[model samples]
Target: MPETTAASSRTGRLLAAPLALILSVGSLTACGPTDDGPHADGTRPSSVTSPSVTSPSASGPSAPGAPSVPAAGKTAGTGPTTRHTASSSPAAGRDPDDPDDRLHQWMESGSIPMNASYHWPMLDTSARLADGEKFLFEEHCGARRTPETDSLARAAWMEKARPGKNDGDQNWLAQETIAAHLQDGKRKASALFGGLAKELQACGSAHTSVTYTTRDSRHVAATIVLDKDTARPTTLHEYLAVVGDNVLELSLWATPYHQDGGNKPDVAWPGPPDTSVFQAMTTPVCPQGKQC
Candidate 1:
């Protein structure tokens, strides 16, 4: 990634953390669209290059002992209300009936509640044809081979800001979702999820611990607390859910201490935002052309 300024350099570092999760996908044979294109098994068109991660200024770290969810019926914002910094709606003129558009809609709506919760201005967002294999395999998160499926659509969002009271404090969160065309949605979901579970297993060690809150055939959720043995630890809550032919990946990252050596924020880390909207991506009715 090229950087013209210190801010861009820092953003790249921060973006890499989330993109690293993409690398864990390994080989996903039988995972992509069967229509004409680069085989989903791991090849990318020569034209498209891997995306670069980027960062922004700072926000305070997660408060010690923050609650993971807000009280029932209440939204999750902890500080005084802040003006919305970004729009969560889909672009105008998109065909509502297009399969890709439907997938984009799912990704956008699922993020609205979360974005509204903490004034987490959207730093970046992307909706593109699925082409993460080359990038994912490069990370080598213990997959035997790279995944081969080209999703019908893939969407990603990055949110970060200085929503804290202290200078140089920061909070970051990201979510990515992919919808594939598959004959057996359940089986494909299970297989891809196995890869994710494997990566999570490999990611745990002395510096970090993984605690799963939900694990089953269609959905999996876990929380990882890092640097727990040391001061200024951080937490990352991860979720994976397969709805029909769509799968959602979300990460809530909270640093309990400032990376810039600034004081902690006055507010607590607002835990994982509600994900029911994402969990329902393919329900009520499947996408126009999807097998689900």
Candidate 2:
């Protein structure tokens, strides 16, 4: 086969699997008809592509010392609170329900419409965050956009290898499916992305107040964190963007300390690159900006 054809064929499997998990939440449960939202004609341009999937780089569980989940209802950020941020007011229009947009693709399949750094089996272990981190992830975890958020609908997720069972990959997975309230043709999805950025910031900030010794830095489009102090050193990165009435967010966590070969891995911390998670979130622009 020609090089171009062969390359496409090789990547096909990487893009097709793992879609089931992203779209499993079948109910459109929270949206109403568009009164003053999206295009006046109720139409959006066709999307050139749909949501794609990226397999993990082989998996295991949580970080080195992340504690197991405690009994339900015992965690931080437990109650809902009215929160505000700069330029984060959600619009009042309904997001357009286009079947071909990236949001729809994600809704149809529980998958991140992007390829992972490498493909590997999903780690069979359960989520395990440190005592404080666990509370933050299971409870304060900002992926779950709150009711105060201007989102009419949303889906959030994270995938990681069990720290002990993992095969030494340096990444995990995270995703959020957000449907924003649109108004006057603009989807105002940016507010949703902004909201998520704020949540992650809050999460990172909480890290300092807690006992976890995670090290982190921010990139233009995403944030990267390293946890070498744990039994298994892990790396995590994520990015978020708004598309029409939808916001796509992706995060990846990995553990490569086994390869570093030391109690404190000597590998130099590298800035997170523009991974497919970044590319997928940035792509899929609708002319009206709210239809996706």
**Model 2: per-residue Cα lDDT over 1-292, one tens digit each:** 6999989987886666555444453333235323334444676534333223222331444345754443444563332232212223332121223222112223211124223333333222222211111111323343445564423232211112222222344334443333433442233445544555555656554232222222222212444443435566444444455555544444444445454465332333344345534444444434324434
lDDT score of residue 180 within candidate 2? 33
RMSD of each: 32.8, 32.9
lDDT score, candidate 2, position 218: 20
Question: In lDDT terms, how accurate is model 1?
Answer: 0.47
TM-score of each: 0.44, 0.36
lDDT (CA) per prediction: 0.47, 0.38
Error of 1 at 289 (Å): 18
lDDT of 1 at 107: 41
Count of clashes, each model? 21, 27
| Candidate topping TM-score | 1
The candidate scoring highest on lDDT is 1
Model 1 ranges with Cα > 4 A deviation: 1-102, 108-117, 120-125, 128-130, 133-170, 183-185, 230-232, 256-267, 271-292
